[model samples]
Target chain A: MKKLINSAESLTADALAGMAAAHPDLRIDPRTHVISRADAPVPGKVGVVSGGGAGHEPLHGGYVGRGMLDAAVVGEVFTSPTPDRILAALRAADSGRGVLQIVKNYTGDTLNFAMAAELAEDLGIAVRTVVVDDDAATGTPDGTPGRSAGRRGTGATVFVERVCGALAEQGADLTAVADAGARVNAATRSIAIALTACTVPAVGRAGFELPDDRIEFGVGIHGEPGLRTEPLRPASEIVQDALAVLLDQLPPGDDDRTIVMVNGLGATPLLELYVVLNEASAVLRKAGLTVAHTLVGNYVTALDMAGVSLTVCRADERTLGLWNTPVNTPALRWGC
Target chain B: MKKLINSAESLTADALAGMAAAHPDLRIDPRTHVISRADAPVPGKVGVVSGGGAGHEPLHGGYVGRGMLDAAVVGEVFTSPTPDRILAALRAADSGRGVLQIVKNYTGDTLNFAMAAELAEDLGIAVRTVVVDDDAATGTPDGTPGRSAGRRGTGATVFVERVCGALAEQGADLTAVADAGARVNAATRSIAIALTACTVPAVGRAGFELPDDRIEFGVGIHGEPGLRTEPLRPASEIVQDALAVLLDQLPPGDDDRTIVMVNGLGATPLLELYVVLNEASAVLRKAGLTVAHTLVGNYVTALDMAGVSLTVCRADERTLGLWNTPVNTPALRWGC
Candidate 1:
């Protein structure tokens, strides 16, 4: 696959070791693959933890630091973390105040995180779970929208992590943090487009094939087939088409405020992301929403997939205040 | 090339417009392609300005904001900016304090910036220039390291902008900022490798072809030929080999403190970059150098090439302090 890796078997482990070496503030357990802040389990503050597959850079792991996630349990590339591993992260992250689990709405991820939460409760540690399913793409494999596996969580998980983590850092109780996450997830919508598929290290080939003149709209992070394959259009039109799905779902409100994220799936350059964001901002303004903040970069990436994803979240004064709060993480950092 | 661009003719302009739209704090002139901070020409503070070929995201443009470059003049993809455009940037960025020009060690960039500096001085604004030439790649076309256009500046350009930018933000005069940048350029060294060639949109083809089983070692940013080409090796071994070249150039000392940056050349995933940094730290320590800080990610990029570059800079107390100063640019930010 011509990737800069040692081997497919040790990809996640080697990466975690490298991350820990780079950031001294982060502590890692090599066996459990749980990366936590050195000062995790803050006595008075509620602990925040999240986990999923490891291919998405800066998702759960890079967000582990002050004013964000306390612990991040990592799984194999595009594979779910085990119940025991999630349980280990829960145990490591919780102090006296309890822990909150932010999970994506994948079948394996939800199942494993739920099992871990149940096991943590058996040990007298309070745990709460928030499942994020904010992808706005149409036509799942099953005809029903809410009946099948449901929309795969894509970009809203980033919102859930930031909002919930900030609230918890302010010493909010477990319920408040979990509720904040739920609200963010409910208000958020995301859609992605991919020009090329990503190759998993083990598989050693692209997940799917795409013609040069066509693109996949509403593609997922793992290179899953999108809602449909269509002829490639200009970047401006692609952004408008993606946000059309979001605008349809958003309720009309006067003086509405919004937070936008133009996230690169993997191999897309940061320059193109700014273009996507500029186009998204224009369409959002046309719909009477002010983009309060715009983040354009390659955060929450798939493994070398060439694409960009748009995340639009309805924000209030409180959400804006929390997002502006000082965050000191590897990927997202500002105002500190 | 399947790039997310409107057209080859308007890629840079479109990206610049998008960046300006995303960041209201920065002001841009479409005709001149000059981007400056809204608060540029801060009466008493020294101005920092940089420009080069476009294609390197977050280099000259993204570095324009508070505590960094006051202005960035952009050029066409892989082409140098015209002297007139650069003169415009110099004029806009200058306050009472003279402007310091940071130019990469490329033939076109150096010649154009020199002309611009002369024009700015003629218009009654003082100007100083620092040219970076830290690439450690072997086999220049002329076969002489000291002559024949010298080494093409690669990753160390980020260090030059940062350390010098921080000093300028702290009110360092033009000469002081230029000297700091020169010292950084002298102490820094960088080497890059490429697994695949990046395609320029206008060209509509890859810059060069490399077999799947081999890689170009010590390659320059524009798919320039490197010291040699060899069979693909594991990430760990490749890192060791790259460092061996640096170790030769680096003077040995007791308790030496160094700053390490593992830069991804655009298309490499962040997951693989951490692995490179981890191996680099191990090798640096084995050589008795104390690694003070390690920055890992795609700071300096080469379009869509799949590769990684390593930059190591010897640092003293002052250099470390300057590096810690808060930088609120679009790409790098910390320590407010």
Candidate 2:
């Protein structure tokens, strides 16, 4: 129960200040804990805004830049950003093209972002909101499959957030942007595994206890325990377990094109992710589906959990192409 | 030494296969270990390629998409990608426009990418290379800030990799791209702090040890030891200590604009990063340097080490603008 910090209460503020010092290209509105590119309000572009609790680095804040998100409103560690702060971010990211809010499906996130969108509309700024409900297994207690993960967005949300942001940057109107987001939500499915528990800075203890040589499947980003626990298996078997659940949640299809994402839950290495990808791909192929794209990395991490997640998106040509579009954020960049 | 895996020898290969399955858009050239977007050779775009070892997730491989890098070559573990793999990535990303290689400034990365560029030239493809040497505190064993490491690349490489990739994606020529990369490398300086050691999967043991209430400053990504070990200080003091080393490495000036980055080595939470950021900004402002932009997240990660790193870049209008450019990859997305 030890960490590097001055005081438990001062953790979030101190970290935000460090971020401002580290990345000069990002405009850190410390007052609101919102991050936007220094040269925000790009002429004629639809401003894209996204946020959630802290702990999931590079997801909301790190994705702030040109192609991904215009502004990211961060909450306290694993806590939702207050409505006022979210509104402020919406206000800042807004342009004549309008603003789109990428909200994870978590209860607090949805409520706050929804309120912020309403507030933006009250200000005569057109705003649309998309709630990422990509976590197929949500709201369920630990060790349950097909049970809801209680609003956990998981890795699939990364696609929902970034793809929507990308389209917004391309000047897509709020409706189109929201529709694109919904399209991804409808197509994407995620299942995560956790090898170790994370420790919230304030808490100063492991989020959960995982027996050595054991792993959990279908864990949430906020250390929400997990769906089930089992003995550690080969990377392939772990991939199978996660992918089985994900594929089952996806629309039944044979030969349908899908985008496969092998995401590390923070601590897992690229090699492990690749191994998970191999097994996940085999599952997809065995199910008679074609994997049109493969993305393996730490997209939506859960601190240092040392595990991986599999996300399968049933993508069409447009969604796939947009996935190919360029985005310049700290954690990801390429196709722009 | 307690890791959950069936075998360590087959880790990399198995992980690659899993990644291919999960993200179908990524084309995994297994033999070459070069990952590319399935729809590569995007019409009318200059191709950009990057690569290195397998441990760094979302780096060269995760970055291969629409906007950021056109392709990425992968190697085993922390080792550099082979010249042949780089050549394959260049060819895959090539769209008749010249190819640019964005390389980190490690010895292995430099030599391998250099050789690959020559090989690409021999193949009659226009290829250029830009190496990023952002670390200001050099000569640290393990290429980290100190010893007790096994080849660490602190997350600061994100600055050079993403910035360079963003420029290249915008159709910047090889020379311009390389120049921009070099500029960032020259302006940026990074230092890290570690709380606990990370164990490479193959090694199966922690790289180093720290007392329950102690902190190690100037640590590296690969679980390297640190330059200074002291009683675990407040997050504020940690930020100050890192800034002391990083700023000292940079050219002193009150007039220069700076970009701040607080990077997590892997396991450190977002809350801690913000804590570190808070203190860093105070110190920077006191130094009379205006903070321009900021990026805080897990950019370059060590293998789930409990640590964080700080990167400060002297930025101007040009660098800041480039940082905002659109990039499309699994991890980052900006201008769509």
Best by DockQ: 1
Over the true interface residues, superposed, what is the Cα RMSD of model 1? 1.0
Question: In model 2 chain B, where is the ten-residue run with the lowest total lDDT?
Answer: B141-150
- Go through the candidates in order and give each one's DockQ: 0.75, 0.39
Clashing residue pairs in candidate 1 (N, C-alpha, C atoms within 3 angstroms): none
Summarize candidate 2's per-residue lDDT along A272-308 as a digit string, tens digits.
Answer: 6666666666777898888787666667777656777
Give the number of the best model, judged by lDDT. Answer: 1
How many angstroms is residue B52 displaced in model 2 relative to the true structure, after the best TM-score fit?
6.3
Q: Per-residue lDDT of B140-183 in model 2, one digit per residue for the tens?
A: 42234332322233454566667776776677776787787767
Model 1 off-target regions past 4 Å? Answer: A138-147, A251-255, B138-147, B251-255
Model 2 CA lDDT for position B228: 71
Predicted structure with the largest TM-score when compared to the true one: 1
Q: What proportion of the true contacts does each candidate reproduce?
A: 0.64, 0.69
Candidate 1 lDDT over B1-336, as tens digits, reads 778877888788889888987788899899999999898887888888998888888777988887778999999988999999999999989997899999988999999999999999999999999888888884232325744888778787888888988998888888899999988887888889998889888998999999989999988888998777898988999999999877676544333899999998888889999989888989998988878888898888888888999999988777889998889888888886
